[model samples]
Target: MVNFRKYISGITVLASGFFLAQSTVSTVLYTPAYENQKSTLNLPSPITSMVEKAILSPKELVDINVNTMMSDPVLKNATWGFVVYDPKTKKVISSYNENTPLVPASTTKLLTTETALSLLGENYRWMTQLEYSGSIDENGVLNGNLYIVGSGDPSLGTNKAGAWSYKEIVSDFVSGISREGIKKVNGDIIIQTALFKGNISRLPENVVWLENNNYYLPAGTTQEINPANEKLIVKKGNSFSAEKKYFYVSPYMNQMVYADKYDGDGILTTKLPDAPAYLANSFKTTLVKSGVSVTGKVTPRMTDGTPESRKMISAYKSPTLADIVYYTNQHSDNSLAEALLKTVGFQKLGDQTSESGRSVVTEHLKDISFDLNGLSYVDGSGLSRSNLVTPISQVKYLTSLMNEKYYKTYLTSLPIGGQSGTLKRMFLGTGNGQIFAKTGTLSRVKTLAGYMKTNSGKTLVFSLLVNNYSGSVDMVKKRMEKILEPALDL
Candidate 1:
């Protein structure tokens, strides 16, 4: 999405009041070029009258700083776009190449998270129901299959030590089923996952690099893993295709890790090909320990054709949508963001694919009057390189959110500079929670977007996106800070 426009002859300023497609010709560093000169880097209109008036405003200072920083030699090859808008006045204070679409990276989560907040209310929760299709006899032995229908709750059993962990959820299920007076089950435990439609326990196609990734788990009796096994490598293979263990392990990572014991709780994950079967097995094992018996194996199905006589045994409810959004944006959780997108697609478009979800997002943006002319919303998590959005479009999107009822909730969920989430290490000792934003980074891209309160006590929505910069990340960051530090105090 980077606007790779390069000029070699004359300087021209676009309608956005900022320079773009400047000359790449070799010249002295920071040398100003005029329209009548040989290069395309246009010098701005001189402030002859302003100096004659002998008056200076913060906006003028910002303009000066932005122009100075952007004219550096290092940015000669960079494709950049930025916009600073006053939400209250609905006016652009300053902008440069704002309409140029660029890769947003994880900043795409803003669209996903915001769409989720607007579509799915704050109180919405994903529910997993437990039910049975068969009946129990007088000897406390049952002949029916136990069923678990998932709603694609991404946080299900994520925190191993939390109350809603896998072990805890399984314990709750076992106790509830045991209270039904059924001591044994003669049939297999059925896992119903029709709510979500896609590959389970595996990375999405766009994120194939995540394959064979190992997640560490704590060693404890409460946890399902053994103390000696500290790592769970998520891989894609079909060695146990006949059985339920369709997930493969990384032979290399397995051999490298030799844990004699573990000290903390493990990470609960569903990186298997069949997550329902994994859950069913974990549930079955815990149920047996809790004085219940199951003689059948665990299996997964995409249907819930139980007869009308089927009864609900118990259900687990997830945290509210607001809390989920908090974690999703704060941690930049790619999986949760994708899940939200799919959920949006499933609700609005009756499909769960990323394409469908992005369509839903586009529709929502249309409803808000966002200019989507050249923008592309491929995946919600922004892990894909296909996402493209202009800084002007992003600023407009942020400005429109002020009208939403959950605007405060959405703002609170973003990372506060130097304080929370991904921004904890950013804006240190400077912005220090004054900036609420989302960061996007890739090999040659760096972006920051959100709201920042200026020293004059006015809130401004801004987006700064730069791509193809030939410099170290820290160097670019320092340059970005040079521009932002003055703006933050504007």
Candidate 2:
């Protein structure tokens, strides 16, 4: 007696009603924002109403990307990004592609440094210890081999390595050995740098600033390699024809008396780094005109690290782990990042080997609990395309840094905008640097991630990452830098 057609119609209506009801469920449930107060925000219609009402009816935060704003070709084409967070309301304002994982380039360092700060601390410095297993006498003469141990010193045999000259490290080793009442070593000097345990790749192919052959950490191997000293290399480049040739000066203890003229052209690639490699290689170009070579000489090394380095006496005591982290964040040194990653692995896994170290770091990051899928990390130095990260996880890592005691120190440790470090002169005229955040870059990827206050004076964390795009990075950089300026007027 029942009508089958009627019953079917009834069920269909019910399903439709259910779906419509579900659609009606407010998005404000997830994101915190004042739909009305957010009227000023340039967003879609549905989200605008939702946000407007949420401000009137409730108070909280979340991100809702159930819209086409992000997928919109115009916006998406202009900036390959998704941002949802308000510094003013301390909540997620809007989002698109929020979950899509994108390569963050150097922005990944924010995560590495921030995670390191929370787990490692600000007062931490790398320790370069000196161990000797030989006999010394009152005559200041060593009768055995002097072992110099390295644990990934970012600033060894380079000025930033320790503010001391390679000569000083040598002198310190001699003085320390002398203090230990020893001179005239009768045994070989063995430099033991087995601290880091990983395969380090060699320097990049486009390297030009090897002002000194001291930028020794190539990519594929991982071990605590020590440069001879804390030397900031200086190279002067001359534009010979349309080509450039450079002469390098070592951070010798002796003052450089370059009182000569009659050079090639006026281009001094000075301030080249001595160690922690990449920075040193940053000073060059290829022989475009062909048949171009450099003819520069060291004032005269006390003696390079040839077979003779075996007899050099020295001590190896690194700074605290915290100091090491600060230096890494501030200077943005690549080799140093590799060393720290290994150290973290060694610290966490209890095995000072690269395999274990990589595992430890990976495991620790997983413990972070952010949903980062398809993100692979082989080394800490983002030098590897094998490394991957999502915007969400990196932000989570930064948020975790808040729990640290020296978090302020950690914050400052980041290169400031337009002031010092990597970011110096970048956003200097922005007036925004009176307060704001960080920047990171590498081949094909550009990212700006960090904290900044909104127009309401409430600080909000944001990250903008652009990857795999074929265009002018310089233009992209300009566009990215301009976005943060007047928007909040910060």
Which candidate achieves the best TM-score against the true structure? Answer: 1
Clashes of each: 2, 60
Which stretch of 10 consecutive residues in model 1 shows the poorest summed lDDT?
238-247
**What root-mean-square deviation over C-alphas does model 2 reach?**
14.4
Give per-model TM-scores. 0.75, 0.60
**Model 1 segments more than 4 A misplaced:** 1-55, 160-163, 199-274, 304-308
Q: Please, what are the lDDT tens digits per residue for candidate 1 over residues 290-378?
A: 77878887787776565435688889888888988888888777667878988998888877666678899999989988899768888
Instruction: Report the Cα lDDT for candidate 2.
Output: 0.47
Per-residue CA lDDT of model 2 for 421-478, tens digit only, reads 6667566555346434555555556666776544556555656666654444544454
After best superposition, candidate 1 residue 462: deviation in angstroms? 0.3
Quote the positional error of residue 224 for candidate 2 in Å.
24
